[model samples]
Target: MNRLAALLLDRRLVAPDLLATGPIPDLRGPVPASWQGLSRTVSVSEGLIALEADLLELGCALSAPLRRRLAELDAWELTIAGRHIVGAMRSKVGGHVDHVPLFRGFPESVPEDAFDFYVRRVFTVLLQEPEQPCVLCGKVATVHPVSPCAHLVCRACWDGSDFSACPICHRRIDPDDPFLLVSAPDAEDDTARDLVPHPRLRLLSLCEDPWAAAEKCVRELLSGQAALRPEDLESVAAFVDTCAPRSARWLPDVIPSREGKATALAALLARAPETLPDLLDRHVDTATDVLRLLNAAMDGDAGLRRARPIAARCPAGSAGRCWTA
Candidate 1:
């Protein structure tokens, strides 16, 4: 298999579910019929209208003030491909790129105060989920992040297994870790803010490798296809090894934690499409969780076991290992 396919084949297949940043549509309306057109693709929903409508409603619900602001903005210019919302921007002076469509525009030229107005407005609407009960548990959403499945689950109710498939589109979650967690507000003081990556963000990051697999899976999902490769199981094992332990204590209990990783491996072994994205999105309490789990798994292995102690004993040695003071 090629490197991309090889990555998928290496892990135990975990089916991807609704784990995208926002709700993307299916085949959108603006398909580039020939090679000359610029086609926009979003991983969330199938098309722009579907994506926009949802956000519009969400924006309105955020606040009457925000709703008024949205009403004042010029009409949007949109491109649709199949059900996917390919592109969106306001038809105004220096239209801004609508990355998530939570706001009308986010142009660099826009004043920070104006941008902050939009930002705060969106958050107000988002924070009002008590009115919109979760699709899974039917409870007010305290910390629900919508999965690709489009089903919202309360953080308290999410089992991390229900979304074992691309809930909305039915793609397998790649076994590569695509997420991280911060225990509390201060945990992220030293981290970068890449993806709304605040310390309190429910799930912090995604796995780099599986994100590639997700790209491929998106094609397969759109085409109604399935895939299985023996190498994927190995990839799952390797992916597990990537988890490094952190110092925080809440690292392991959030989701399937261990079971989530195991489930991905099992899916690879079974060669079935299970929702792996939801599991990958769990929070970690600390880096120590990753290290401890990895350390225990490496115990019986001759190569790793032999090397760990040597490095542990020589804190300042040539080896890359560092002692924990």
Candidate 2:
């Protein structure tokens, strides 16, 4: 039997109408030529039946009672079978016409909205089935989300890892996709915190070099750390200036001015010795103002003179005189 028919029959949603009393066809034997593409299986004793056919043909074959039963249940999957054609019954009309058709008889050019609608209907019906244990840990599921493979997964199985893709189907979860369920905000926050490299040792192990380690340390500190230690800030500034000199300029904007700004500036100057001269030449006025600030914050001229190499590259004019003076 087709997947949809098997699902409905297993759920006991559409059983054979036994009181009608007629010779039920044997589905296990060879079906007639007229029923070539269709498969129908009926069991009067168990009150179970399975039916599969082309979209249009299935509409023409089901009994009035069975059709009425399916309609009452809002079975969009079966109801939408021949809906693309004109004069289709309103009861059978699918909500959206943009999805690709799942049946073999459907035209290849069917719209994407129609295909998506079909897949969604399948999921809707599948969700109604009794909740199954989580595919991963076999634990009782409190919540269900559609996996990339269209299977329903328990929240416990889903939450055990940091995977954005389905463990079963390996399909990536798109947050905006209608077919998938979005995680709750608190759950997402918990997941984020769990994934973050916490504790200095773990963060350090994840980094390949000193620069990366410093970046991780800074990220951890900025993401709601109660206080910033002076040594940590100084280390980050030095690492950025030494390994990524051009990135030094960004520190003034990202690091709060109240948090040891002078110490950071000093580290930047010490580590970015080579790039400092070119940076000063490019932004002579801004560099001069910053140097003046740094000098004023220093204890003596010896510390200020450390920036002399940068000052020598100033433009040869009034700007140059202003910088040297």
Candidate 3:
């Protein structure tokens, strides 16, 4: 079954009546054709994502202003997606378009010469030790390293090639590498299917209003660890964004990282700014954590940039620079 694209709405824009009331009408939009059941998952921060990995297929999905690739869009498309998010934060629909591809899950294109790509895979298989049985023939054979990439080629199965690039990496290797050959034919149909599976599709929630998203992250993010490991930043931000302010009591007693504590409190306080004093008194532990909250508030004053809480990047220890950067 095809999955409809999910929209993650900031709770502030959601009227209290709408949230308190029955099931609301979902904001509808056209989805990308590539977003089939199979696609990479995605993520986003309240802010601060490095453009490339923050948006690339292998990069971090969580970040703000702009995130990574889940679709076939370029930087302009990414910026447009970010602009829509920016507008949603400001509650402005004056000039914004309703439907745009915001997905970071784009399909990839492989080499056209199917057989050449398949046969080239032998170099990848040869990465195993030459002393072991030959990967191609399943028996011990004389294996020699190709010139530049140095991928071992099984002499028993095939001699060499005349291709310009390294078969495994598809990069330009030594032109004279004995493995490069023009005559290498492609694999048969059965073998082709086995090799064609693309990267597993990852589900990245983009402003989807699901309480489950927050609950799923609580066990993993709000751990007793002192400082957030570099990788935890994305998970932490996602948790804070998805969490509801009323559920603040559900927060862990001790949120370890200064960054984590501030993020949680800021996201909570954004919608319920009246509780600012109490949240500050209770959750705001250190001076740095206070600065983190202050930094978010400063950027998003008067609901102008309300998505600031999750946008706050920089790890805990980078105290002085955290506010400025």
User: How does each model score on TM-score?
Assistant: 0.22, 0.23, 0.32
lDDT of 1 by residue, 1-325 (tens): 1233233322312112212223333321222223123234322222222333333222211121222222232222122111111121111112232222322221111122322223332233344333444434334445333332223345565445544543323334432421122122233431112122111211111123554454444222222223323343243333332321110111233333332333232222222113222222343235643443334233322112244442222113211221211
Off by over 4 Å in 2: 1-227, 252-254, 274-325
lDDT by residue (tens digit), candidate 2, 1-325 = 2222222222222332221223222222222334234333312211111121122111212222343343332222322322211112111334332222223222212222332332343233333433433434544344354443333456654552566665543457654441355332343331222211111100000111323444544444433334456545444444454445644544433433323344444444554444444444433345544654354224222224344333332223423333354
**Per-prediction backbone clash count:** 79, 10, 35
lDDT digits (tens) for residues 1-325 of candidate 3: 0011112333221111112223222323444454445433232311112122112222112221112221224333333344333334323323343322223232221112222323333332333222423323434455554444333346665455556653433446655556533232245532222221112211123333345544545545766585655445545445554455544655676666666666565565554444455556666766666666666544332212344443444334333333233
Error of 2 at 282 (Å): 13
Candidate achieving the largest lDDT: 3
Q: Which stretches of candidate 3 lie over 4 Å from their true place?
A: 1-186, 190-213, 229-231, 299-325
Measured on C-alpha atoms, candidate 1 has an lDDT of: 0.28
lDDT by candidate, in order shown:
0.28, 0.33, 0.38
